[model samples]
Every structure is written in structure tokens, then in C-alpha cells.
Target chain A: MRFSVLGVGTSFVESAMAETHGFADCDMNSQLLSPRLRRRMSSATRLALTAGERACADANVDVSSVPSVFASIAGEIKVTDTLCRNIAGRDFPLSPTQFHNSVHNTAAGYWSMVTKNKHAAQALGAGENTWVMGLLESCCQLRSLTDKVLLICYEEAAPEPLVMGEQISDCAVAMLLGIPSDKKRSVCIYQQRVEHAGASTELWSPVSAALALAKAVRHPQNSSKLPISSTAHGWYAEVVHGE
Target chain B: MKQLSQSIPITAYSAVTACGLGNTPLYMALESGKNCLQPLELFHIDIPTCVGEVREVLPEISESLRRFDTRNARLALATLNCEKGSVRHAVMHAIEQYGADRIGVVIGTSTSGMYETELAYEYFRDKQHMPESFDFLNQHAWGATADYLKYELGLSGPAYAISTACSSSSKAIASAQRLIASGVCDAVLAGGVDSLCRLTLYGFSSLELLSEKPCTPLDKNRQGINLGEGGALLLLEKPDSQHADRPHLLGCGESSDAYHMTAPHPDGLGAQQAMHIALTQAGLSTKEIDYVNLHATGTVMNDASEMKAIKAIFQSGVKCSGTKGITGHTLGAAGAIESIISLLALECGMMPGTAGLTEADTAFQYDVMGASETTASVRTVMSNNFGFGGNNASLIFGQYADNG
Candidate 1:
């Protein structure tokens, strides 16, 4: 029911900025991916890797040694829309790169390829009670399977039809989680209630919920039943000092 | 294997595929050695190939759940409504046995309703906007179908979707197991629903991986894959003495090739690790495995890599076969459909054969079945599904026997 958060990393962009230049603000300067690799990826994936790499550095863990769970709401929607446009236009040849990168697990696959980690990586909706689901996913792996897991929640700024005709902040958050231990300084995350944010349009919202949890992990306070949601989606969790 | 996952009971299951509606037709086709794949008729394709299309006329989503109307959702409904509503009755029973709030739903899909979305995009290209009838959140968005199942079933527990391409549903099963294993939910409706779409067809075609003829896995003259579509659902519950007669999902293992975006590892190291982990979690050795549902997509590279992995895991005599010959490649739903096929094999004591295979590749250390149906006293079966992005998942199911 509880797991330790060893480190957290986040990347956030203003809604207005994300709307105008979703890719211009992308900071792909991380040391984990090469420049060639950076150019080949979508901005959403770059943000995910940037946050995941930073979380690994913050946790002082080798990225190659850990498994991961990459969550997203409208994963690869941009690329998918493009491919659909190509197909509708009667374009004969679909780009193989875009087709392969169009999967929801694109970020997870990229993370593993960069690190050469054979550890199991999972990709889920990563939304709808979005990051809470991500946290629960991490804790489940910790409880039943892996010792350490990298949990990354990221979403691209959805295009017009997919969103509510408004821009949401572009953000990606990553947390390194492990089984709670007295030997390590960590924050204990316990699920208070599972939420289904099914009907909410917050899929395009900023990663504010994930950011709140990361910020809570930083607070030197023992709080139970902390409310975190980007919208009216009801979900609650608690974080306590593990050290 | 750091830990042995509890063998969760599969209380109920149903599937809709090319053969027909429900597991009965699927099993009948497997038993009669029938190839259900036929020439594509659901949609037009420039490429000449056969696909395992669900020939049954799909039901319309009720006006109340019209927002969920899509080929994918309809396929799920067909499966749920199949066999005079066994899976539906099981869900209702589970809700009464355990609180509705204690049940969860997790479905997998490579594409929820990309077919509809692709049509919408065509309108947008011409009209500059989508039709008012299209609701991406309920129809085409990620996790939409899982959410549809949750709301349709009136359950309030955790629900989501896994979208790791081909391994989506198997991973969904693993997540369902985790929900039970982690004490989060008493039961979960876990499986996958994928419909044939132009994107996947064109995508794989552009890669030159589409076999013009029927896909013949493990055949010396194997070409490529014939894409298929279907939905399969399994009700996984916490271990119960009451349901001990049902088959148990022994264990699951997932790994990444970390080798290529689309291609698998040449030596099948990741595939081997996944099989090893699944067996370790099942607390069984290779000798105990009665059959393996190979993830052979009828591609030369895929079969070659998976064969190496098979060689590394099982000895020469272990029975194995690829069902893509009969069903074509179902993409996301392949995992759950094949798992159900394995469960059927255990129940009927009939091992499926390679439907379109003429000759098995002789370079392997394992036994790959041909057109001849092989029946044996099968106890435990393993199914493998490896997807793009190097995602690989293996699941083991065995007949529940307390004495063993």
C-alpha cells in the first residue's frame, strides 16, 4: 500500500507558450540522449526523458539498473493525427519512423534503448486520476515485483480537436520509487482513494497534479490524505517522511 | 524471479474474433483445424492480403452509451454478449460477491478507435472540423474503452488501459494480477480489444511486413503478417477456494529488447528473460510446460528471433505452434485471445496447429506443429506476445489441481 519516493524531477511550460511553440520550448539538453537522438524524438518524448534522466540523477541511481512505467493521456496523438492526415490524403507511403514512434510506449522504449536496460518497462494511460494511477502503478510493482521503478508521467499539448479548443501546459514529471526502507531518506506514498477521472477534459491540462505530488515529496511534513487533482476528478493520497 | 506472484483464478472469460462470436466458435475452429482468416471485406485495402475479420454483424451501442460507439467498443460488447451472456453474468455475480467498488477494469488496445478517428480526420481535412457525433474522450482517446467498460458495468474501482502495441493486453492481465496481488481490488476484468484500422495496415505495409498470402508462421516460405482484429476479456479474481476449479493465471513476465524500435533482438535474450521470469513466477521448470503459444507474426525476423528465444527456454520436444495462421495478427488483442486459446487447449486437451504452415523451420530446437492437430494431456501452457518498442510479455496458465 506504501512505497518510498527516492527522487523527483519535473518539466513544465505555460499554456500559452505550449500553444504557440510546443517544440520551440523543448529542452532536449539532457546528457542521457545524444543530439542525434534528440532530433529524432517528439517534444513530448524529449520532455519525458529529460525528467526521467533528472530523476535518476537526483535519486543517485543508475538509470540502466531500474525498470520504468511511462504514463500519458493522449499519447502520440500528434503523430497519430499526422499519420491519419497522410492516409486520408491518399499518401502512398507512411513514414516508418512516425508509425513506430506512434505507440503509447514510445517513451518507455526510448528510455530503455538509451539506457540499454532490459528491466521490464510498462506504459499505461498514465492519466484519468492520472498521476495517482501512475503512483499506484509504481507502488504495485514495488509491492509485488521490482525493487526500484522509474515512474514518468508526461503528456503532449493536445491538438485542437482532441482538446477543448484551449491549450494546456506541457509538463512531464518523473519519480524514482522503491520499497520503503529505514536506511534511505525517502517519502512514503500511500493510496488514500482510487479515483476515475474518466469524463474530465484534464487530459490536456498541465502536469499540475503530478507536480503537486512531487512538491509534496519535497515538503518536510507528514501529511495524510492530501488532495491532488487537476480538475474535479476526486482522488486523494498521503505522503509521510520515510527517513 | 524476485517473487512468485499468487496464481489468481480466472473465473470467467469470452472472446470475439474472425471465427465467430464467443470462445465456442474459436475453440471449434481450433479443434476442427479450420482457418478462419479470409480475404479482407470490412474495408478496402490496396494490398492483396487476407485478414481475420469478425464476420458477425456488430451490435449497435445503446443511445445511453452512444458516446462509446466504435468498432472497438462494439467488438468488446460482442465478446461480453457472446455465449448467451456468461461473462456479463459472471461480472454481475462478482459485483454481488465482492462490492462493486472492489472490482476494477483494465483493457488493452493498440488503437481504441483509430478507424473512426481516421474517418473524422478525412472530414476535417475537407471541412476544417470534426463531426459533432465524434467524442474522442469516450471513443478514440487512450483508456476510453476501459472507461467505457467501467461505466457500462457500473463499477467504481480503478480502471485504465495499457497501450504497449501488441503486448497491451497481456500487460493488462499482469496489471490485473497486480491489482489482486496488491490488495487494491478483489477482481478485475482484464484483456484487450483491438479493431483493424488503416493505420496499422498501412503502417505495417510501409514496413514491407505485410504478407500478400495467408501468414504462415514457422514455415520455410513464410512471408509476413496478415493483420486481424478482435476483443477478449478475462475475469481475474483473488485466489478463492470456491473458484479453485477454474484455470489460474500462474505467472507473467515482461521485458524489453532494448534492441530496436520495431525489430526484436537477434538472439532473443529479452524474450528468453521474459519466459524465464514467467516460469520462475509460476514456480515451474521448462519440463512441466505442455504447450507454448508462440508470438510468431509470420515475419522472417520475428519468427527467427522468437525461435532462438524458444530454443533457449524449452527443449526440442516441447509442443509449440503459432496461431496467426488461423487468426492473422490481432495486434493488441493477440495476447488475450491467444491466452484463451491456450486455456481452451488445456480444457479440450487439443493443441492448436500452424494453420497455414506447410513446413516447420528445421533450425529450431523446439517442436513447431504443422497442419496436423496434436492432442495431449496438457496441464500448463505459456503464451508470448512481443510488440514494437521492444516490449515483450509472457503469461502462463495452468489447470488448477490442488494436489499438484
Candidate 2:
């Protein structure tokens, strides 16, 4: 029920984390991917890799050795919309690269290739509860395997037609969690059971869960509880920062 | 790397493919060595290709679930409706034993209601406006299938969708096992469903990975894959003393190739690792395996790499076949569909042969089933499903024994 948060990474609004001491720019550079692969990656993939690499660097862990779970609300909308447009045009041939990168796990696959991480990589989608579910899956992995898990959650703005008046944005967050040790500045994540109720109205957006979790991590307080997100069974996450 | 202390049971499962609407027809086709692939007819494409389209006239969704209707969801509903609604029966039973909140749903899908989006786009192009009936929230969402299934079944547990391409469903099964093992849930509905669409058809064709003829895995003249569509679901539960007769999900091994975006490793290192890991976790040696359902999509690289991995693992005695020659590659649903086929092999004591394979490739030293079904006393079987992102997964299923 307890784990250490060794590192944290975020790529939300530009310059939001720039003022923090340990935080770096949220920009996704071409350092982790080749030019060709970088060009082929969608915005979601870039955000995920950027946050994952930064977390690994911040934690002083090798990216290739860790198992990872990537979560997203909407995956590769740009590529999907483009493909739909091409199909509507009765186009004989669609772009092969776009099709390959269109899968929801494209970013996870690209991360593996970039870091040569052969361990298990999982990609999941759960409407607004993606971040919490990703954390839950990672915690389960850590408990079962006795190893650190890299959890990354990202969301890309859906196209205009798909968004249909909803306000979606681009953001990514990554965390390294494992059994708490004597390591410096490690926060404990506690998973608790709560009563079933309607989803909370506080910052109810796809990216809000990760943003809230990041805020708590950056500015630690005494046992501050943050509501991650609610699931069908009213299962949600609340992080407890250790003193 | 730790092994599961107890085995999980696959209490119920159903599959709908071009071979047939239910498990019986699929099993019959495998027994008779029938190939159900025909020229692609579900959609219009300028290229000549073949696909394993579900020929059964799918039943329309009920009025209440009309908003969730799509080719993908309909295929899923049809597959779930198979075995006389065995999945529903199993779920309801689980709800009685474990609270509805104690059951979880994990489904895998690559394209969920994408065909509807394509249609809406077409309508927009012609009419200069989107159709009023188009429901993007219900149809275009990647988590639509899982949400719909959860709503239909009225299960209030953790539900999500895994979208790791072809390995999606296989990983979904693995994730469900984790949920049970972690004590987060007592039972889970785990599987995958993907319906054929113009996006996939034209996409594969553009990649030059689509074959005009039926795919011939391990054949000397194997060219490429023949894409197909279908749905497969499995109800996995934590086994106790009472559930002794259910088929056991022995173990699941997952690994990323980290080699390429689409192409597999030439030496099949990741595939071998997955098989080795699965065997280790199952506490069984390679000699104990009786059959293997290969991820051979018939593409030159895919078949060759998979053969290397299979040869390295089982060597000679184990029987292996790629049913994609019959079912075609079902994309994200391939893992679950093939797992169901593996379970069928265990139950029926019949090893399905590669449907379209004529001349076996001489480069590999493994037993690849040909057009004839191999009747053996199958005990332990393995199914491999590797996907576009170099994502690889292998699952081991064993015949349930009362003495265990």
C-alpha cells in the first residue's frame, strides 16, 4: 500500500513548471528519437517520451531497464482524423507510417525502441480516469515483481470535429514508483478504499488527475489527499505525502 | 519474474470469426481443415485482397444500447452472445458469488467505432455538415467497447481498454490476471474485438503488407497477411477448490521487441524471451508443451522471425500452426481469438493446421501443421500474439485437472 516516488516528470502548459527548482522545460526535443522517427511521432507520442526520459534522468535510473505503463484519454487523434479524411476521399493508398503510428501504444512502442527497453510495456485508456488506472496498474506491478515501475500518462487535444465543444489540451506526466527505501526525498503513495459516489466536480478533465498529482509532488505538504479520478466502482486514488 | 501461486481459470470464452459465428463452427472448421477466407467483400477497395469477414448476419443492438452500436461493438456483442450467452451466464454467476463491484472488465481494441467516424467524415464532405445522429462520444472513443460492455453487464468494477495494437488483447488478458492476483478483483471479463474498416484495409494495402491470396504462413511462397475481423472474450476468475474442472490460464509473458516500429527483430530475441518467461512462470518446461498457436501473419519478416523463435523454444516435438491462414490476422483481437483457439485445441484434442500453407518453408526446423489436423492428446498449449510496436506476448493454457 506504500511506495516511493523517486522521480517525477511533466509536460503540461508551457513554462508552468519552469519556475520549480528541479523541474525542466516541457518541450519535447529530438534527443530521444531519430529525425525520421521524431517526424513520424504524433504530439501524444512526443509528450509521453519527453516526460518519460526526464523522469528517468531525474531519478538517475536507466530507462531501458524499467517496466512502464502508458495511459492516455485519447490516443493519436491527429493521425486518426487524417486517416479518416483520406478514407473519406476514396484514396487508394493511405500513408503507411501514419497507419503504424495510429495505434494507441505508438508512444510506448517508440519509447521502447528509443531506450531499448525490453521489459513489459503496457498502454491503457480509461476515459478520464486514465492517470489513476495507470498508477494502480503500476502499483500492482511493483507489488508483484518487487521492482520499480515507470507510469506515464499523456493526452493530446482531439480534433475540432471530435472534440465537439469540449476543451481538451495536451499534457503528459511520468512517475517512478517502488518500495520505499532510504533514498532521499521519496514520497509515499497510499491506495485507499472510499465510498461510491458520483465523480468529483473538482477539476474534472482528462489531464486534471495528472496535474493535481504533479502539484502535490512538487509542493509537498503534511498528508495532503488528492482525488485522482473515479472508476465504475467508485474506486479512486488519493496520494498521501509522507512527512 | 515471480510465479503465480495459484492458477487462474478461464471459466467461459466465445469467439466470432469468418470461420463461423460461435465456437462450435470455429472448432468444426478446424477439425475439417476448412479454410473460410474469401475475397474481401465487406468494403470497397481498389485492390484485390482477401479477408476473413464474419459472414453471419449480426443481430441489431437493442433500443436501449443503440447509442453504443457499431461494427466493432456489434461484433463484440455477437461474440459475447455465443455459446448461448455463456459469458453473460458466467458474469451473472460471478456477480452472485462476488459483488458486482468485485468484478472487472479489460478489453483490447485498436479501432473502436472508427468506421463510424469515417462514414461521418464522408457525410460531411458531401453535405458540408456532420450528421445529426453521429455520436462521437459514444462511437469514436477508444474506450467505447469497454464502457459499453460494462454498462451492458452492469458490472461496477474497474474497467479499461488496452490498445497495444495486435498484442492488445493478449496484454488485456495478462492485465486481468494481474487484477485477480493483486486481489483487486475476483473475476474479470477479458478479451478483444476489432471490426474490419476501410482505414485498416487501405492502411495495410498501402504498407504493401496485404496479400491478394489467402495468407500462407510458413509456406515457401508466403507473401503477406490477409487482414480479418472478429471478436473473442474470456471470463477469467481466481480458481478455488470448487472450480477444478475449468481450463487454467497457466501464465502470460509479455515483452517489447524494442527493435522497430512495425518490423520484428530478425533473430526473434523478444519473442523467445516472451516464450521463455511464460514457460518459467507456468512452472513447465518446453518439453511439456503440446501445441503452439503462432503469430505468423504470413508477412515475410513476421513468418521468418516467428519461425526462428519457435524453433529456438520447442525445437521439434511440439506441434505449431498459424491459424491466421484461416481466420486472417484479426489485428488487436488476434491474441484473444488465438487463445480461444488454443483452448479449443486443448479441449478437443485436435491441433489446428495452417489453413493456406501448401509447401512448408525448409529454412526452419520446427513442426508446422499443414492442411491436415493433428489429433493428439493435447495438455498444455501456448498462443503468441506480436503487434505493430514490437509488442510481444505469449500465454500458456493447460488442461484443468481435478487432482491439482
Candidate 3:
């Protein structure tokens, strides 16, 4: 089964660095989100919900109606750092809210809470290949279980002073993937084995690969083969546009 | 889309926990009904809560894969190389049956290298930067454990990590089943690994969900959860002519509570939906399940909601119990560890009971086994794991006949 890109919600990605060989800026919509909940949200959760709301709105589907799959490289890196610092100090005064938000699915959980979406949701991490793996997972669900699935890939900026702080930046990309029904941009993905990951030297987040997919959705007339990001084990995705 | 009924056979499975190194130790502890939880020693905690530490000395990761070293990787490596484990043999066999490229790795973990990162942060406290030894990509990333498994096993087909809090591994198994069903992977090594770290211990403590002693999951006097560390792996493959006597993963149903960030729905509406969906997908009635391994964490709200959901579905009174009282709450690995327990119940025809449950909660009418049942004829089992995001997943397993 191929996925028809029903909607593409990508905002706040550094496309100059994320684009494959050639990618591109974001439009985040937050009017639907509650300000109280949004204020307390971690960066990852905020970005995911922003993109998720946009994707659902673009697809003309209620956010609560569809199951979601969230992908990330390092989820809530800042929150993790804060909690780590707290524990190392033996403060014993850690915030319960911070502890609850430390889960890798922080974004997925918050999205569910705000939208009241009880549909099955998943959060995943695959290092560099997180974007494609999320796609693989979403594809599996669309093929066997659900007709439509919301896939969101997000990453918060790495904690400062750490080496990763320089390599990683904030980015969130969401796609509403469904079975081929409309004339929307449809793509079929297959796995490929490699000696080294495609973007190994850059340590690219799934944001780049997802940004490339977002670019594809915008200009489907290009109809060129797109190479998604690769995993640490040299696993990558080869996306073929469905006519 | 109830394709979960396709029946994916578990070719082989193994688990390493505070109980011991392999399935034997886990089963023995269950049969002996020993409380494996002990005084917290892995890390210094001000609280008096107990912890389930893998007392066994873990093997060191190979030098080639040294960069991916962490307690979580150690836990996963212990399972991978356990002497009594069937994974080493089964994975090699799968490589021969299906090219190494056809077999996938789907591992679940909540905090993959968070403990190591915590230590690295301590280094940052003094050095201004993390130690030169700290490798973020290999050591601290959430997918590190899964990559370590893929590299160690030398198998590569769509590998990734699922980290949906407590339901991580069960969801990983469910995804593996779908991968095989989707024809992308012929066989998949699926399970989860989680190590006790200050993050979860202190994290749960901050929530006031940590019990000062051994946790009683379904008892009226139940306090809270005792953090634990361990991992379990089950190799699931498309059914073949062989291994029919083995237990097969029949169906998986997943849902979100959408009620709150940390608390479950008041009546466990999502939990009930997950159970109903799983039963419908498996094409079985509540009475068909021989037993249930609840996601009972020994917390007041969690236990009540889960029990209410259970009663709503299994009103006829199917056998049920919580095993976390023995192993403590393994967090991300809870799903896989408990799944192995359920599979063991089906294969060994023995039901492991709630270890810390001294007295059953008076509110719930269904009996939560307080002692292991040595004599039982079990044909099917249901395992439930609910996590922080209100993520609820239920898995059904049963024996499948082989074509000789």
C-alpha cells in the first residue's frame, strides 16, 4: 500500500541545512491549542502539537479522530537535562510535571490530552533514521489497521555546552498519510541497505528527510525519487512517487 | 483492519530481570513465589522504597561496540548472550531461513541511555563540557539499544525503537507483528530493555508513586510501585510448519486515554476499549482467555481504573493477576517482561501470582491470584500494559497448531 499525503504541516525547520542536495519554512497554527496547556508544554510537545494541529486541519480531519505516530531523535532533551541536574544535586524537589513530561512520548501524550484522541498513538526513536522508521510504522498501521494515520516527527534543540548542542536544532514535521484515494501526492517507500548512513557525517535529524518529503508534497509535479534519511545501521528509505 | 488475527508465532523468547538471567530463573521465581525485590543499591536514593536490580554481573559490551555502552545496553546484552536464552540460536536460524536483510529489530525502551547521560551531566558539572568519552549518537540516543542489538546480531531489516513509556515493548511486539504481516520483514526480534536509573526512581518518587516497601499491586493496603531494571526479547516470525507447539501472538489492541497526561481515565474508558479491540481482533471471547497479566503498578488510581476496565470486559470472572509485585515495575520493559510471563503461563501451564498482594482489594469482585498456581490447564492469555501518555496496549497469545 502507498501513502497519499493528505496534508503536510512543517514549520520552523532550517531547510538550508535540512534539504536533500537541494529542501526549504514552516507555517505553525496554534489557535486551536489551549494557552494554559501550551505554556507548560516542552518544546518537543509544542512543536508536535503545532504541526499535528496544522496537519489535521489541512487534511480536514479532527485531531481527535485519527491515531498518531510521533518520531524523535532525542525527545525532550532540555527537560531531561533539567531533571538530570536536579537528581545529581540530590535536591529531591524535582517537579512532578517535569518528571511526567520526560517521557519520549511527551508530545504524543500531550496531543492526546488536548485533542481527547483515544485512538492508538505511538512514539518512536530511531536515531538518525527516526523519520523513515516513523513512516515505516505509520505505513504498517495504514496498510493493516487504520485507513488514515497522523505521523509527526519532532526534535528539540540539544542541551547547550554539550557536543550535540551544536549538531542538533529544533524541528517538527507532520504528515497526514492515508490510503490512496485522492489525487494528493502519493509515495511508496522501500528499504535499502548501505555501508554508511546517507547523512552520517552531518548527524542529520529526521527533520531533513521529512522536510524533503514535505517538499515533495508541495511540488508533486517534480516526480523525482527521494532518498529519506538512514539509520545508524545503514538502513534508509527509497521513496517512489505514485502516479 | 483486524489483521492481528493472522497469528504470528513466537519462535523463541527470553527475559533477564532481577529474578535472574534467563526464562528458567523467571519461571522458578514465579513458581517459588519469591520476592526478588531488595533494598535499593544500584543508586543512592533518600527514599526507603525497594528496587528490583539484576543482581547478576552483566557482561561487558564488545570493544567494537564500546561506544554504545550503557546500563540499558548491558541489560539488553545480558539477554542477548544469556546461556539459557533461545535468541542466539533462533536469530542465527532466522538469518538462514530469511536473509539477514529480511529480519528486523524493533526494541522498546523509555530511557535508552538516560542514566549514562545523567552521569555525563555530572561530568559536565566539573569539566564545563561532557567527558570526551560521552558519545551522544551511540550512547545517549533513544535508539542506541536497538542499534546495539542490530549490530551485535548482524541482522538489518527496518530496525527502530519504540518508546511510549511503559507500553513501549508491547507496542514494539505489535509493530513487529505488523512488519511480518506487511511482508517487509520475515522475522523480527521484538521486546524492550529498561535499566533502573535515578530518572525513573526519582521521577516516580516525585509523583508520590513509589512504595516504601515491596509493592502490592491489587491489595487494599497497596502503596505504590517499586522501580526495577531488566529486559526481555521474543523473536516473532510469520508462522511456518514448525514450532506449532509454541505460543503465538494472536492480536494487539492499542489506544490512548486522552484524559490526562499522567492519570488514566476515571473509568478506564480507553483501557476498556483497548481490551475490547484486542478481543475482537483475536476473535476470542473474554472467557477464552485462561489468565490476564495486568498492568497493575500498585498505585491507587491506576489499579482502580485498570480493575474497573477489567471488570467491565471480563464480568464473567476470568482468571487474572499482577506479576509486578515480584519483579517490581520494569517501566519500558514491563510490557515485554510481562508478555514473557504470559507466554510462560501458556507454555508451562502455570500461572504466576501477585507476590506482594497480601489481601485483595475489597472493591473489585474478581479474584487476583495471591499465590502461583502450579496446576492449571491454560490455552490462552492476555497481557496489558498502560503507560504515562495514557497509552494502553493489550496483547492476546494462544497456542497454534502446526502442519506436520
Candidate 4:
């Protein structure tokens, strides 16, 4: 089995539910979303689409042909807060737009809907291992149905008081997978199970799957296997090592 | 396509709805031809619209689930209670009976813990204070419901939440069947659950899709949709000698319209693709489908487009019905809940009527069964769910053990 990392896109952190800043700004991590649409959407939707679009652009792949898999641990927490409040208030009414945006896959759904890509798309949420699971599912789907897949993993900043002092970072990463061609940049997904992280928790944290993946693609190590801790519980980390 | 044979099948099933609990009651009510919809009374529904609110109440959580006060937690715990215990308990029984660690749990939900998290934020806003009980990891994420199930049940294999709006839970079951077929999980617990929240009401109202009176799916005089909430659970196992009683999850197809963010393509192109995919994957032509559980929510765009999609896919005289008229569109849980209804149809070999559907929108071509049961072989059935942002999924299920 052969696959390659085709393209990648990302989003810098934005405050909860705030409009994403323009991509050209020094922080170029985020992209501007139309005010008309942003007013009706949640931050999670904005961040996911922004990063997804960039990744598609990087891979030079048309969004229409590429199947997409969105992996998010926590999606649209701010919307969750608002919906919960309305329910508890008993007299408060729910917003239709907010309700639509509140759905978990709204981010990925928006990406597909906006891009007008009728291809396969899915939104998956797991625990810490969400990124890893997302990668695995993306690979499996790509291998099963089509020749290529675009996997976008993102975590939006949770609304205040929701994180409960949990050290959370807002990050988004996209990877394009397909049968590797000699002329194209490629990587092979090597699956393995390891017991522990070699370094400190801060450096070897499970959420660092993105960093490891980025590093593996950026600087290919001699070893063909990379070990990762599970982002979700009880699951082992997998390494995608290639030359 | 490698001549895809040996499709997945739905075996055993159960559900809870505003109509009532259990297959027998729901089936009885559907057969009685009485509308189960009522005003949104579960939470002081401030929006003043009708809802298919499941007849449930705040539950007394077990010592194990006391900390999970989010709406998803409440629904999960209540659903488990309805089934007798935690998912682990249920799966253990299936495993002991069926004999396999290859068991998997796939669930679909939309609001999830948002209802609880909103309450926590409201605590800070209304009382001008925050609560210590508010845990972000537990209540505010999309995966909270699935994660809670995994933890509570100790499910070690593949587990995740499918968040495709109304079609979510249904997709979970479909995906579980794929994994099981691919030899990922043996037996699977598949379904979806969601609770009512004010945000949903106000949100739909803003879109002008909410109805003041009961929704009428195919009625020319239809006003709008009446949103509802509930949960359904089904136990799916790979057919074997030990398990001769369950239904089989035949096949499934998923597609996105990518046409509009909120509004479905006027032509129902995405919906057409979804239905087509399911039919093709099941390796059955349109003629083979005994009945269809349409995603007819009564909204003008959704109904018209879905009808168009249905007409384009099925033959001129294919039998189909929209049960949402009885259940009141369960949003993310619709797919899973409706699948149970489809399974029920296969179990009894009777098709439930399209409740509240008075006038067949003459524009639709297929035979729309309303307010009655249509008895047929029901060897193959298709269920459709289209979500916001163009996400659409279709599942096909066949009667279990059809050697006779």
C-alpha cells in the first residue's frame, strides 16, 4: 500500500466565535470569512473551513474530486454553551442559524457545501486520539473508495469556563493522501504500537501527532516507523515513517 | 466494484420517542394511525412551536454517571436505563450470547452536551457566576457523548461520533456495519440520541423553518417543520450460527450535495446521489427496494427537493413513506431512530403510514403510503437522511436470515 502527503493548510488561534482574521495579516494563520456568513456561523466552522481550503490549495487538488475527513476533538463549544443556556433558561428561544451551526460536523459540512464538492466527506470526533483516529479513518476511506483523500484535523478554542483549566491549544492541520508517484512528494503510513513517550509530557504529548506528522513529512528520518501516543484513550499511537 | 455481495444487515433493535417507548408501542401507535406529535412541553419550550418531544424526564443518574449532567449525558443515561443498564452491560449480554470481543458501538448525535454547556454559561451570565461542576472536557465537545459511552462501557475498539445533522446517528450505524464487515468490530451497538434545547428552536425560527402548528410533510397546506428529539438503539451482529435471530444491515451509501450551506439543492442532486449510492452499494436496483423511509421534514425546500430526488431514483410505482410526520424530525437522531423504524417494518413485514400527510404533493411520482400499513415481503429497505451544509447519507437493510 502506498500513499503520499499531497497538501496542507492550517489556522492560527482566534478567540471563541470571533471572526477569523485575514490570511495576509502577520498572523496569516487565519483567513477572513464573509461577515454575512460569519454572523451565522460558529468559530469552529470558520477555522475548519479556512484550514481546509488552504490545504486543498497546497495540494493543488480540486476540492470536488478529493474525499475529505474532518477530525475534531471538540467542535463548536461556544455554540454548545449557547444552546445549553437557552434550554436551561426555559423561556429563551433557540436560534435556527445557531442551531444549524451547533451541529457537530457544521465545520466540515460548511467546507463541502461552500466548495460545492459532492464527493465523500465525514466529521469524526473522538477524545485526545481524535487526530490519530482521523488519520486512520481517512486512510481507510481513501483506500476503500477513491484514489485520494484530504484529512483535516482541527481543535477550536473552547469558550471560557468550559476548558476547566485544561491546557488546550487551537490548531488545524490538513493532509492529502493517495497512491504516491515518484515525481510527487509521498509518505507511507507505518502502523506500530509503543508503550510510552520518550521525553517530557510537554514535548511528547499525544496531541503532538500533528507536530510529529509535520516533522516526518518535513524531515524524513532514517527509521521507517514513527511511534505516537493515542489522542483518545486506550488506543496506541501509529507512526507514518518514510524516506 | 468487485461484484460487492454479502451486504451488512440490521438484526435486533429498540428505540424511545415522544410517540412512546419500545418497538411494540411505537409500531402500535404508527399502526393506529394517530399523530404522536404534541406541543414542545418537555422544557418550558419558550418558542411556542409543536415538537415530537420524547415522553421522558430528568433522570436519576446512577452513581457512575452522576457527574455527567449534560443533556447528552442525561439522554445517554436515560437511554441506557430504558435498555436496563450501561452499554457495557448490553454489549456484554450480546457478546455472551453471540460470543465476540469484535463488538463495536457507533452513535450519532447533534446537540450532544451543548444543552448542558449552555446552561453552565447561563449560570455565569444569569446568576453573574460560574459553577464548579462545569467541565469543558466532559460537556462542551462534539465527542462528549461518544466518549462517555466508550468510558462507561469500556469499549476498546473503534468508537466515534457522526455529526451530520439529522442523519448523524444513522450514519454511525452504517459506518459500524462497514467496520464489522471489514473485520474491525464483531457485534455493534448503533443508534443516535439528542435532547431538546432552546437554541434549536430559536435557530429554526430564525431560518423561518419552524411551524406554529403540527407539520404536514406532503400537505400542500404545510406551514413548516415541527422539530423533535429522541434516541434509538440497535444491536447489529455479523450473521453466524450462534445468532440466527437478528436482522442484517444490508448496504449503505453517503454523499454530499455541496450545493448550499443551509438550503438543499433545489433539484435535490445531493439527495439523489445519496439514494443512488445506497442502491448501488446494496447491489439492488430500484425495483428491489420494498419501501423507503424518506427524510420528509415538511419544510418546503426539503420536502420538494427530497420528493424530486425520490422521483428521480425510484420507479414510478415504488412504495415509500415519510415516518417523520409521526416522529417530528429528530434532527441528528433522525437517521438512527428512523432506521429502527425501518427494521421494525422488516420485522413485522408492515410499512408504517406517512402520518399527517393528507395531500400527496402531486409532483411526487412514487406511491406515498399514508396513515396505514402496506404489507409486503420487505426484503430490502432504504432509509434517507439529508443534513444542513449538504451532508446526505443513505442506508439499506435487508430481512435477516431469508433462506426460506
Best by TM-score: 3
How good is the docking of model 3, as DockQ?
0.73
Model 4, B335-356: lDDT tens digits are 9888988888887888878788
Model 2 pairs whose backbones collide? none
Models ranked on lDDT: 3, 1, 2, 4
Top-down TM-score ranking: 3, 1, 2, 4
The TM-score that candidate 1 achieves is 0.94
DockQ of each: 0.65, 0.67, 0.73, 0.46
* TM-score for each of the candidates: 0.94, 0.94, 0.95, 0.87
For model 1, state the Cα shift of residue A101 in Å: 0.9
**Roughly what TM-score does model 2 have, to 2 decimal places?**
0.94
The CA lDDT at B316 in model 4 is: 60
List A-chain TM-scores for all predictions: 0.82, 0.84, 0.85, 0.77
Give per-residue CA lDDT, model 1, range A4-118, as digits (tens): 7887776554535433433234344567888899888887788788889888988999989998988887787778878988988989789989999898999889888999989
Clash pairs for candidate 3? A11-A26, A19-A23
Mark the regions of model 3 whose C-alpha exceeds 4 Å error after superposition.
A13-29, A161-168, A195-199, A231-243, B401-404
